[model samples]
Target: MKMDAFAFGITNWAEIDRTEHQGETGMAYWRTRYFGNYPNQIRVRWVEYTPGYRADHWCHKGHVLFCMEGELETTLDDGRKFVLTSGMSYQVGDNAEAHQSYSRSGAKLFIVD
Candidate 1:
């Protein structure tokens, strides 16, 4: 991804408003910040997944994601699956692989896309 022009900044995630996203089986809450303009923007987020959460759709967007607490399982459209636990991270390019996620016991993550 191209890094766009943006000034230095610090974020207090707790001060950001949380938005809810419904999953196939649960819910996800996110605190997000966007930098730069659309199409070249950088999105940074603090996210939480409710227990038994399973993404409702396949995502083709690129991301740099870090697991901060609990666990997350990611499944590719081709059936490949992987797991992430605290301190683990994954990176994927835009349109690289269509993927979805699940969390059986809830999780926290930091993501940039």
Candidate 2:
């Protein structure tokens, strides 16, 4: 299906149940469209973290994180830490460090690659 600019639909994360990954924390809002009957190389997902939640240490092929709400802290394997709040965004991967995220008041992030 072809979509024009601004022709996509809005997907609400709260309406869907969170999928549990064995070692990951937070709920995820996910959506994707295939290209030419095959999976697309890029994916966009919104991840919501509850208070006192943290994710397992992992590395991505390439990713960008956009903080949509609340606060989140990420600690890298090298002990470097970054704190992000609403309206902030960062890119990682292709030499991206391994890291984990933690939130106290909860947070929502849009991740894309």
Candidate 3:
């Protein structure tokens, strides 16, 4: 990824407005901040998943996702599954794989894509 030049800044996630996204089985809330513009923009988010959450679709977009609290399970379309707990993270490239997420006990995460 090419990162265009930009100034450094700090974000107070609590001050950001959260938008809700319905999952297949539960709900997800996200506080997002964007740097640059679409096509080349970087999306940074603070996300929360409710218990029993399951992603509604397979995501082919890449991401750098970090688990901040609780646990999360990510399953690839090919039947591979991986788990993430606090302090754990995963990185994937754009269009590399189609994956979906699930959380049995809910979770908090930081993601950039």
Q: lDDT tens digits, residues 2-50, model 1?
A: 7789899999898999999999999999999999888788999999999
With a 3 Å backbone cut-off (N, CA, C), the pairs that clash in candidate 1 are none
TM-score per candidate, chains pooled: 0.97, 0.69, 0.97
Residues 43-95 of candidate 3 have per-residue lDDT tens digits of 99999999999999999999999999999999998999999999999999999
Q: Which candidate order results from sorting by lDDT in descending order?
A: 1, 3, 2
Whichever of 2 and 3 has more lDDT, that candidate is: 3
Question: Which candidate wins on lDDT?
Answer: 1
Measured over all alpha carbons after superposition, the RMSD of each candidate to the real structure, in angstroms, is: 0.7, 4.7, 0.8
Report model 1's TM-score to 2 decimal places. Answer: 0.97
Candidate no. 2 TM-score:
0.69
Clashing pairs in 3: none
Better of 1 and 3 by lDDT: 1
Residue lDDT tens for model 2, 1-113: 22223444556656645554433655433433222222334455777777777776556456688999999898877989999999998888755687777887888888876
Off by over 4 Å in 1: none
